[model samples]
Target: MSFAKVFRTRSFRDVRQALLEREEIALVDVREEDPHARSHPLFAANLPLSRLELDAPVRLPRLAVPIVVFDDGEGLAERAAERLEELGYTHVTLLEGGLQGWRDAGGELFKDVNVPSKAFGELVESERHTPSMPPSQVQALLDREANVVVLDARRYDEYHTMNIPGSISVPGAELVLRARQIAPDPATRIIVNCAGRTRGIIGAQSLINAGVPNPVAALRNGTMGWTLAGQALAHGSSRRFDPHVDDHVRLVSADAARNVANRARVGRTSRDEARRWAGEAVRTVYRFDVRTPEEYEAGHVPGFRSAPGGQLVQETDMFAPVRGARVILADNDGVRANMTASWLAQMNIEVYVVDGLMPADFAEKSSGPSARHAPTPPAVDELTPTELRTLLQSPGTAVLDFTTSANYVEHHIPGAWFVIRSNLEQALLKLPAAQRYVLTCGSSLLARFAAPEVVALTGKPVQVLSGGTNAWIDADLPLEIGETRMASPRIDRYRRPYEGTDNAREAMNAYLEWEYGLVAQLGRDGTHGFHVI
Candidate 1:
């Protein structure tokens, strides 16, 4: 059969109708993060062409699941669709007319990533009227040493970077499980804050939903509000919630969280049942251990990947791009998984919690990174760090760094030029002609995949740097920092207003204003299946 006959094209209306009906579908944008963030369908998850081979299996678990790939005139969708088919995908289609078709059909293209989760947060605040306190009131309470405990509902790294005075890092899903211990006094006011609004609102509401005794309120606009009010944030704060909860507290928290989950209509499944679902050929089931990364690394179920509950909720599209697929969360303590599942349930996902698991059930233990599945890279000649250094001294030898723009700016080989993997053809044309080329990314995994492509493009002696740039760093080799030599534009990452410490005041205000209007936008789009209990 011809390629066109095997892989058909899907129109914007067809994709939107499928989403509205909650049918299984993966609407993917094949561009890099920066372009994808500039505009895309509300549910379009970014699976960039550069890392598609590495992330496809994990993000889209079912090979036969329907997938519609699109690109905004970058000429990447058809190539991506072909790659998916090469990777054994049975059902892959191109989006008709690419991203422009969606615009022509009057589809709403959302800005920034994680639109669904952020929009859901806005909806919850709109419907439940989740209580919030502006920065001024919170500051006034803190000045007088009021009976309050501040909890930062962001990752530890973000908390360490900048935080409210005397705030403890409790993250989003951790709030319900750790609130009582952090503020044992029922009279103590509990305030939740993130860099911005979403996590703050969700964390405060999570505590309230779990029936915590203490009064809770979101720090309105989060740390952004604090900063805009001329309040100085404490940097390098180390305070964090203790993970070791008492047995009685664990049981109580688990009961409360489970009750919340039940109210949200989340399902419960046994380990055996979850395995059965995973083994089914017709369905896609993602098994995740929804615990802190440290805890997950120490011990976890064999097949479950580590997905911290807070991040999973905040970045659901990135974690599970196949909308309407079944998600099974495994948490030994029970509170985190149940609470996280409650939010996912309301997000119109078919989510379940693994019931009745003992500590012994988590037999697999690892202190390293989680396992990822990808096609074996084509064999290419590799030059060790020392050998590459020697080769660079000679003429007609060039190095291409396929790492992220952020990483390239931070540190890279002394003379290596930054290049985007998907845009290699154009980038190579920009570089001076060389007799031989060397490819390296942060870990060389991407470089290995790009070696054959480089050979096919230039017919040159293309080789990968052994162990990648990281190995060079480990070898005490000199490195370069900043955008020194760029063969391609740095469009791999999208800088968010909430990230980093030096964001302009105007940008921060604009981000909060954008979030405020998400509820209305969600209504106009009319595809999200979110609800509030």
Candidate 2:
């Protein structure tokens, strides 16, 4: 069927009108992050085809919510709409001209992921005049051996990748809880940084807002600025916050953070309240355990998914795709949830922290049953590694690798054709007809998710390679490198302009210029109800 006949389309004007009226509409970009990051509407959520099953149920819980899907002419919107319909969504439409149509209609396009949240951060800085120190001044402090401590507010992996010299991995919400532990001497200066500006500003502000005693300032423009100033950055650093603390101290800190959250008008709810919210069919509620991955894996609330407080604030759009949904954060360490909730409240989300769960309720269940929302694998044939090897050498059999594009580029089973599961049907049309098909990913769970889809499309017996490529490697099988075989374009992930070591100077500068103008754009967009408290 033609897209024109099957799907309704909203013009850029219609979308803009909906936004201006503050109607609940999800302007979703069906393209992957890389293309979506290049340009999208201010409120456009990147619900890439690859992650629709895993993310859409949580992001858009209301089946009847108005949703408009678009692509950069990649022929993905219609497919995405189809998937949404299969997922029981009732109101789905396509953007009239996709991305280009929005451009032709003079709708503003934003670059980078999390544009709405990041722009709100910029507005926060402008309104509150968040204090910051230039790279040169911070460098002077390091050279002088002054009583100064630098805290990297990004994820630990990001800090380990690259960081300011002498910075410890503090992450986002941890700043308020652990600042004093690192800087016992009240006179010591505290500098917070991320790869770019938002987390740094928010981290520093979090400390200031929580009334930390030590002087706190963001490393202006963060690591990007540090690089622009020609300062050396430490790589593979192991400096991190001490995990141990007195119970009394943690209780006191939690109390203080709760006070800050209360002042900011952030709400609190009991676990019972969260249960009631979960049952509300009219609204979507996300129950997230705002603790470290280690902590969560060790033991978390039964129904809560792991979304570390720091990363949750950094990537809210990716975590909770729906704009007007209620979020209930869970953490055994109360300080993290309170601090995280404070920021979300400022972002105009109706956020609350679960406050009444007992210590026993958070017991360790490292390897237990899956969470309530875990996807059920479609019933399909399974093949062990040894069996799959024999089939791969057969005349009419093929193997599809469903791993990330980067991982596929690095290594995969020899002769395995890399393919995105979402585009499996279209991708299969170009491949040679096979009597049987085998699907494999890192752990084979994702392979199971795609197995039934491929079966329905090709009318072939699809088998998942049990234990995936990892099992193949364990058996000492040969692996291929580079893009040896690709059935789909590499558009699964976005490369950040400010991340890593080798960004072009012009792109970095252009990125900064774009950030500087976001507050103005927010004013014009008028859709985001962001406010600085």
Candidate 3:
């Protein structure tokens, strides 16, 4: 089909709707990966116009599926569509005004989109959550409370380059885990701000999105509002005012790390104890295999959960709130899971490392015994693409495509579903448990690390894509593609209050003294995180 004939143009709202519904459409941005990763459609999968080879069609499941492509004033969408047509992708379209049009339409974009559009949509639509705060209200609250916390959601370098006078730098993803460290009082108002509106909005929304009760809001129009309001913008100022004062060494001994790993209060199940915990006699054991989202999606041990090591480490409280919930860390190696287990143990959270469940690359990443070990996984047990396609037709087999969202969009095995690794739980709940579960990714590693956890969550028989879908593609397997997907909740309307970290406390006298003392020692200290002024 001609680009004009088959294109179903979508606005941000339309795209969001598609993403919300989990429709079968591909939102293709014709920009390169790096720039696009910084800010683009939350649901849009990227395929640079420069590489729309006919081989691309072989990657996708169905060439007939709608493929909407856009460009960021690069004037490349038309070329991309034309190329797709040449590749026998008859159903191809382009954004009329390109990326700029989407932006002008108030399309929901993000800074470094983390979760998939569907996963993020689920996060955005999570009920019992409030919408973001209007920009004015956020500013007003910050003005009213002199001590109110205004946190910059960008990275450290970004904050150092330009920021408000008193705003603290707390990257958005870090907000939840570190909240207690930034804001001391639940009563303290929190205001989230970023270079522009999206990050601030989403960052604030993430907390409120998770049902955090603190009063929080996003800076209206971002720092531009502050500037327009006659407030001065600060730049090139001291990056670290208080200076880091930690005396503890970054120990790398495996034994030392394991000891630290043993201290976590969550996910502390020992290999021997894990089997017992999963027994029918136990009250309930939520088996979670902590690894990269890839490894978990690849294939986990039976009766386990799939969560990334980083998120599991950071948000252990949210995933396992039952306090004593049995937690297991499944990696191909013992390093990370062990170290993570140790940290969780130290935190008073019960956790354990699944000795045999480690994925590959653990040992290489580990230098000292104290460093986390990344275990290599066993040879992948996978289903052929044709087998996967047949299984999808079965009464109870659900296929989860565990590749990066963009890769999944460019080409994925037929009948595969998308699940962002970071938000697997949120995404999984949206699926039906009536089906058997099968996970696939670019590599066997993801499927292997993920399968055990799949069976654990759904109580369904689960399997992995033996070598992963990429292997299937390498064998020239059949594929499918679509243009539309799920939509995100429209949440930018309201003004929410900002409360700082719950764990934040006034620095003790000795802590303050040490901090001041370290301020002078910073030149070659290799210290981290001391922005106190």
Candidate 4:
């Protein structure tokens, strides 16, 4: 049977109806992140074609769940459907006319990454009336060195990139737990900020909800707002939260977080309860350790994955792709997990925090379930860094680097051609007929995944560069720059308008205007079940 006959085709109206009814749906965008970010419906989850096989089983664990894949007429949906079938996904379909069809049907399209969560944040501000201060007010406080501590609720790396003149990296969930130490005097004012609206509002409210005595407010629109106001941000700032927290502080913080969680109606789960949730066949359960990355790296529950509390709240869809999934959070101190669970509960996700799981329940392992569950990749020949250097001298041997496009442009092997993993077959046809092919990425994991496909396509011996480019750089090898070779279009990554050094001011303003209109769009659609207390 033809694809049209075998799998159902869903129109924009059909998908919107499913969303409105609150049925389980995985409206997956099968294109790479770049195009997916440019335009897509609010609820669409991005599972790029490059990593479909690796991500599908975890993100969409239940095979029979409804999945509708779409692309911008890139002809990727058919191929994605075939792959999903191979992976034993039962109810896979393609969107009728791809992204363009949604536009034609009067469906509202959004720009940038994490649209649903960001839009919900805007709604929360509109509904809950989260307190805030404009960039100009914040600048006056900083100029006078006022009794205020600005906390950046974004990841540390983002804080390091650019920040308010004196902001410290406390992240989102850490705001309630770490606030007292940063601002000992109950009279001091606290201001929280992130790259955009979501984290800033959430972080500010976390402190207020936790009942901190000091006044609290969000930096009106975060750093974006600061920039739009023509305020200069500090670049390469190293300010961080003090890591040497005392036991007494930890206990008090945990107590405060627990009280906030109680108000939000977050439930407490035991080990057996979490296990039972995980065993349920019909409902999806996500187990996460809501702690600092360092603590998680030191030791964590064997089955729980590391999702620091702040980032999880900011990027809920990426972690729990299935909207209605059950999530059980773990943390030794209980502060981070409870704070994070409070936000997730408000988001209408069924969430729980493990109350008193023992340290013995954890193992000292850094790998997550995704890596452990990855099927033993098909065997392929391997080459060491020393051996690969000799092979590069050959005329007919091609070195294909599967690293991200931005990284490829920065530096690569002298003759390496950047290739996307999913586009390997087509990319191979464009290469000169070579005797052997060598694959490399940052860690060689992706290269290994692509090796079998490369071998089958060219009928040539394919080998992985052991330890990948990191190893090559460690060995003092010469590198090339500036898109020296390209077998595929640099379409894998979407550069964010809010990120990097030279963002267009007009684009940033346009992005903010788009975000401001999201609540109105949500009113029109009526699918997102976001509520703020």
Q: Best TM-score goes to which candidate? A: 1
The model with the greater lDDT, 1 or 3, is 1
Off by more than 4 A, model 1: 1-7, 367-373
> Per-residue CA lDDT of candidate 1, range 1-533, in tens?
65543459999999989998888999999999999988999999999999888889779888899999999987898889999998888899999888999999999889999989999999999999999999999999999999998999898999999999999998888888898888889999999999999899899999999999998999999999899999999999999888789888888999999999999999999998998888887988889898888888888887788888998999999999998799999998889999999999999999999998999988888653332445778899998999999998988999999999999999999989999999999999888989999999999999999999999999999989999999999999999999888998988899999888899999999999999999999988999989999
Local distance difference test, each candidate? 0.91, 0.85, 0.52, 0.85
Best by lDDT: 1
TM-score of each: 0.97, 0.91, 0.34, 0.93
The residue ranges of model 4 lying beyond 4 angstroms of the native Cα positions read 1-5, 11-14, 246-252, 370-373, 425-433
RMSD of each: 1.8, 2.9, 21.3, 2.5
Over the stretch 1-533, how does candidate 3's per-residue lDDT look in tens digits?
A: 53443455656556555544434456776665555655565445655553344124322334555567887775567666766776667667676567778778766454332323212222222331424455456556666765577777665666777787777876654454344445547777778776545456556654553334568776754554554455567775443312221223112223333543433333444555776765533333445555444444555565455554434544443344323334566655444455445434533344566654444323232111210112334343466767876776667777777665556667877666776442356668766655677777787565665565566677766778767887788888788775223111111111111111121222222222332232233222211111110
> By descending TM-score, how would the candidates be arranged?
1, 4, 2, 3
- Give the TM-score comparing model 4 with the true structure, all chains together: 0.93
Off by over 4 Å in 3: 1-23, 29-48, 51-145, 209-214, 237-533
**How far out, in Å, is residue 23 in model 4?**
3.7
Tell me how many clashing residue pairs each candidate has.
0, 0, 118, 0
Q: How well does model 4 score by local distance difference test?
A: 0.85
After aligning candidate 4 to the native by TM-score, how far in Å is the CA of 271 from where it should be? 1.5
